[model samples]
Target: MRHAIGLKIGPVAFRVGSDWAGPIAALADLYRDYPPPTGVPDYTVRLEAARPWRRWIRPSVTVRGDHMLPDALPLDLAHGVLAAEIGMNLQLALGERRWLLLHASSVERDGRALIMSGESGSGKSTLAAVLATRGWRLMGDEFALIDLATGAARAFPRATSLKNGAIDEMLRHVPDARFGAALTGTPKGRLRHLRPDAQAIARMDAPAIPALILFPQFGRPEAAEAMGPAETFVRLTQASTNYVPLGRAGYDALTRLVTAVPTVAVDYPDTDTAVGMVEQLWAALP
Candidate 1:
């Protein structure tokens, strides 16, 4: 193995190159821990054959092996370690800045922002793609980093993972949208990386203070109902990757965000309805 890149995510650092360097270094920087005390990443990966674009096994990890094969090992072993690393980095980078990585899908229009948080298979990414195609700038999908002090949200503009029916669902809206090859047999079914809007890619690492925290749950019929601040706070913490890991820093950031911003809950049946609800939310922003 050749050490092609070097990075530091808080306390942990990595030296790897070529085939595994980019993803490994990123994993180390983003998550910050390895599998157990061995300090080796524990995860299998499927690369996009481009620059810095990949889908993570919910928890990703690196290990000592002659081959980086995806199907050879237990998924749990890798997921645990890699997820820890990504979670750690998320806490360090965002938490230090008093930001929380709200587990949500976020997009921006004009100057307003809407964050849609939900579990996997909730069509968050599909909605994000729809908004981006309709000219709403993509802020982030999967994670929305909210700046506590300024009430802004940052963008972690990685590839949008589309799975199962979502691939065709988004293609209908974004006919020209580019995508990486499909990766199968992992967690989210058959998944592909949807390229972000070019401008959003340029501002991938940028952060913005939020105006609204909308928790999205795609249901039978499209609808959005605003939740109280207190309920939003609990959900925010639960949605975070490193809320508890950063201890005081994470807690303080979440408190500041919930207090300063108007948090709400939303539900929509399909991508179109979700995007419409988001647009409404943005229009109502002050």
Candidate 2:
């Protein structure tokens, strides 16, 4: 099949078309030991081998998709690689713009960014949906790119993946919310997309200043609390998997982040209280 590569990810431009040869040529760029120029790829590889060695990829090499196969595949198997590919590229692309990718959920309000970061099943996605339904702009439900130099946050617009009763709970509160394309039976369970704000969706590549860095822990009801910027920064940096990968560049970036942004921790039970609590925290930001 012939395909056109439209996305520029890191140093590689993904050129896939209707032709099977499209992926073949794109993968060829992955063979090189040095990072190629803008259009030329550094190396390429087969689809099956993607997950294990993805971390070894360097700007020095361009990875092409040489799997020469149809897009049709089992939903569960396909989602993992797809997520890995998308996540890797998202991290690289935003890094070029000086953003540090944080494994967190982020939403926006009145032009400022509020981040909900935590381990899996920590209720970050649920909180994001609540904020979205309550009139806050949904930046992303999974990954948040924080500009280390400026303490600004950018959107990584994608479907919010909710699981179990979380979906029903969201529907109860936000009957009008739009769910994106369904991707089911994955490792993370059946996943679906939450409709993103059209305007926020359009500005996915744009960055907004960080107003609040929140570490959300959803459970028994409690008053919303604030965490010191220093503590918040420590936790955020610790929670990150790539912060150390960036080394000195990473440290400089993270320091700038806590110094300029107000980092906090929030805990609550239901969506109503969580939304109100987040609002109070944001209201105090400049």
Q: Which candidate number maximizes lDDT?
A: 2
Please give the lDDT score for candidate 1: 0.59
TM-score of each: 0.68, 0.69
Stretches of candidate 1 off by over 4 Å are: 3-98
Worst lDDT 10-window in candidate 2 = 55-64
Against the true structure, candidate 2 reaches a TM-score of: 0.69
Off by over 4 Å in 2: 1-97, 173-177, 181-184
lDDT score for residue 42 of model 2: 27
After TM-score superposition, the amount by which residue 276's alpha carbon in candidate 1 deviates from its true location, in angstroms, is 1.6
lDDT assessment of candidate 2 = 0.59
User: Backbone clashes per model, in order?
Assistant: 27, 26
Model 1 agreement with the true structure over 95-197: per-residue lDDT tens digits: 3434556777788765667677878877777888787888877876777766645656777655576787888887787653376555565554666667676
